[model samples]
Target: MTGKVLPLGLPLAIGFVAQLAISFTDAALVTRLGARELAGVTLALSVFSMTMLFGLGIVTAATPKLAAAHRSRDTGAVRTWYVQGAWLAVLVGLLGTAVLWQTRDILTLLGQSPSSARIAQRYNTGAAVGLPFFLLYVNARGLLTGVGRPKPVTWVMLAAVPVNLGLGCLLTFGAGPVPGLGVFGAGLASTLVRALVVVAVTAVLLGGGFRELALRGARLVPRPAMLLDLARVGVWIGARILLGEGFLPVLAFFVARFGADATTAHAIGLRLESLVVVFALGFSGAATTVAAWARADGDWRALRDLRSSLLLIGLVYSLGLSAVILASSGFTGRVVFGLHEPKAEGMLHKLVFLVVAYFVVDTLITMSMGYLVGLSDTRLPTLVVAAGYWVVGLGTGVLLSELTPLDFYGLWLGVITGGCVIAVFVFARTGQHIASLANSTTEEAPE
Candidate 1:
């Protein structure tokens, strides 16, 4: 299990971290511009991420579908899924960009400060330009992973890191002839790097044995039946993602009311926690592919092994990562980010333990969802996540933050509570579903 998962999961994990490195790099550099800058960019990024993640969820539906087709050597089905996913990616990307372009108006209506809104709008303008390309890259990534060729995508992403960093710095700080664009520069760099990544990955996809699959007698135009088929799965997945991960951006809106210091601290905490979150995502992606293949082969034993491996690995990895986060809290908060302000720094410290707890629980939820996605059991999990995040988590956080002295801490407490609820329900669902599958297989085997 480790052998199968690590090869795929490690590269996927590296790719995810590298992809996030663009934003993380932006945050690290933007911190030099001051807290207001960090706050504004963070707010903009939260909105961008919400939209991007939703679109990503929609596109990722292709992974399991493609994986199943590939495992059966159904070239026609593979081609169709890939092309349909690409078209869908384009459409979602366009819509997401439009929404991001309205960042200022949305922020204002949400009652955020005008200055922050204005700054966020500037950043959004640049970031929004990259939406289509980034979504395209995601779709391509799904295709590659489905075919068990994820290494190319990982390499392309790893290479993009330094390009983003150099471009971000040159545009942000301004040397000699160039004027410093500040937040806008950071956003612009992200856009350019996303475009470059898409081009590079696309080249690799075609240049590698996939050219025939992608271009041979393929319908470039969107077909309604195909689109509908993809949407049938994608919509549930998108909603699950929006509710499961989208809560952070909505929560950020609430945190904004507490002041820039709180918002800054919240943003920093999220960035640090995302490191481990990607690890979960990597494993989740691997689970999805492996599950799809196993299901296609009707291999019950493999499924059982998968569950055991995921549980043991997920627990050990989550705990180890949490410990690292706790130990490095001081260095990360003070020296690395340079959060010298007493209030902001102190609030950040208070958040470390809560962030660790949240990631641990969230990791389990992520792994379960990944396995379920591969099995094509998405609708119920979607509802489960919605109830946990929106109904239970956000509601509790709001009440605590508004009515109690816990303030910022209360918000996170609510988040952790919600995560716990999600973990329990999702794990239960996975166990029951797997047992049903095994029982059916056994009943049909001998008779």
Candidate 2:
């Protein structure tokens, strides 16, 4: 078990670390460019992430389905899922980009500074332009993981990081013949690198890569039935992501009320907190993979065991992360955000605590949903986040900002509140459903 776990966990761990490095490079570079640039890029990245997640959610729906098919050695279904998933990614990505492009001018109306808005438009335009490539990578990865070919992803991602980091730096800061285009240049470079990664991964998949799913061309066309089933799951997950990722910019909007530097600090704090959150996500990713495989095999016992293991994993990891966030709050601010303002100092610990609390809830939510998603239970979780974030969380945040001393902190408070609600709601619903499932299985068993 230990040996089996290590192979899966280690690569994920490394990938998470590499992602952190990419984020850190962004911060370090933009922070040096200036606070306004940081704030601008923050807004850009926030929008970019929101748009990107819709396609990613759709692609993610493939993993467990593919994993389960692989477990049963169903090569045709595996190939079918892969092809359909890719086609779906392209369609979603194209549509999402169109939506984002139409909404590009809204950043100014959203209260960003004129200069920040301009920079944001530039960065977002560059980043958003790469959505198709990005979606292809995500869909391909899901298919690859489903067929137990994660090692290739690990290798490609590892290679992509250094290239991504170096190019982003070179383009932003200007190296040799490359002109320094500031943070916008960085966005361009990041997008380009991501495109390369997708191309490389796609090539590997097409060329009988990683144990070969032995895909049949006839089977490779879109499977409307399979696509619909996954889309049902995908839409709900996409809404969940939209609420979750969309809330960040809204929070940034509220923080902008505090001034540019405050907004920059909020963005900095948000990204820094992601380092801790990513660790939990690494586990979530692994759980999602394992759960999908178990579900496909009809191994209810194994599915239950996988969920238990992931919950335990999330608990231990979340606690350690909470401690680190609380203990090193000041140091993290200095190192990660480069905070020198006296006002920002007092809020740093509060900010880190709020972020940590949010992640603790998030980790549990991810574990529960990842498992339930494997079982194709989507509507409940979607409803949970919809009610939690929009009604309970965002409503309270808006009202309390007027009533209390919480300003930007109010935004973080909203996130914590929303995440807690979603976590509790999802857990209870999943538990009840799983219990009913177990009872049904038992009733049918041995009869």
Candidate 3:
């Protein structure tokens, strides 16, 4: 199990971290501008993430499908899947870009301060410009993972990190020839990195074995039925992603009620906590890939082994991470954010613990969702996500923030509560599904 999963999991995790490194870079650089600019940048990033997620979910449906095709050695089908998903990615990216570019009026309507909204709009212009490229990159990434050839993604991301960081610093802070552009520059630099990554990976795909598929006429035409199938899956998955990720933006919206500094603090907390998220996602992706193969092979024993492996590994990893985050509270304050005041220091420490708790529950939720998604079971999970994130998480946060002593701390409590519900429901669903598979296999066995 380790041999099967580690190869896939490690690269996916590393690539995701590199992908998120841009966000950390933005937060750190923008902090120099003051809390207001930090708040604005954070808001812009959340909006961009939500917008990108729509495309991400849509394109992601292809992963398990492609994995199944690869497992069956259906080369033509694999090529067709990639081609159609590429078209869908372009369409989704274009529309998402247009929507995010127009977020100024939307932010104002959502009750954001005019100054913050303006800055967010300015930053989003650059982010919006690169949305299509990011979408294309996401599609390519899914293909690599689905085919169990994810090492290239790690290499590409490794190559891009320093490039991303260097450009971010240069454009953000201004070098000899360039004037500093602040939040907008941060956006521009990130977009540049996104564009470059797509180009790099595309070249690799075309130059490698995928080129044969490209030359085989699979890239030229669209299959309407499969395209619709992908979109159908994407819609539910997209909604799930929207609900899950939208929690932060929603929390940020409410946090603004506390003050700009509070909003900045929330944003910073989320950015730091993303360190946990990248690893959880790595395991989730591995689970999905492994589950895809199990379903394709109709191997219940492998499925059981995969689940057990995930549980043992996830438990140990989450505990170690929680301990590290708890111990690093002072380090995060002193080194990461440089919080000087006692009040600010205390607030960040409190938020870190809340984030740790949320990460633990979310780990189980993410792993369960990954396995289920591999089976193409997204609709029910969508409802679960909405209930957990919106109904449980948001509901708890609102109650605590408004009526109780927890204040904004109550918001993160909502996050944990919601995640717990999601974890239980998803794991139960997975158990039932696996049991059904086992029963059917038993019935089909020779007498």
Best by TM-score: 3
lDDT of 3 by residue, 1-447 (tens): 867777888898888888787777777778888899899988798788888877888888888887887777787878888888888888888899899988788889888999999999988987787888887887788778888888887899878878877887887789998898887888898889989988888878877566644524566577789889999998888888788877775678788887765666677788676667768787778788788888888888778887777777777788788998899889887787676766667787778888878877777777767788788899999998998888988898889889998878888888888888898888788787788888888998999
Off by over 4 Å in 3: 27-39, 169-185, 209-217, 252-269, 347-352, 396-411
Encode model 2's per-residue lDDT on 99-131: one tens digit a residue. 556434777777667888787777766666677
Q: Order of all candidates by TM-score, from best down to worst?
A: 3, 1, 2
Which candidate has the highest lDDT of all?
A: 1
Model 1, position 254, has a per-residue lDDT of: 90
Ranking of models by lDDT: 1, 3, 2
TM-scores vs. true structure, each candidate: 0.88, 0.86, 0.89
Model 1 scores worst on lDDT over the 10 consecutive residues at 208-217
Kindly report which residue stretches of model 2 are placed more than 4 angstroms away from their true locations once superposed. Answer: 1-10, 20-38, 100-103, 169-184, 206-209, 215-220, 252-269, 395-415
Model 3 residue pairs with clashes: none
Q: lDDT for each of the candidates?
A: 0.86, 0.72, 0.81
| C-alpha lDDT of residue 234 in model 3 | 85
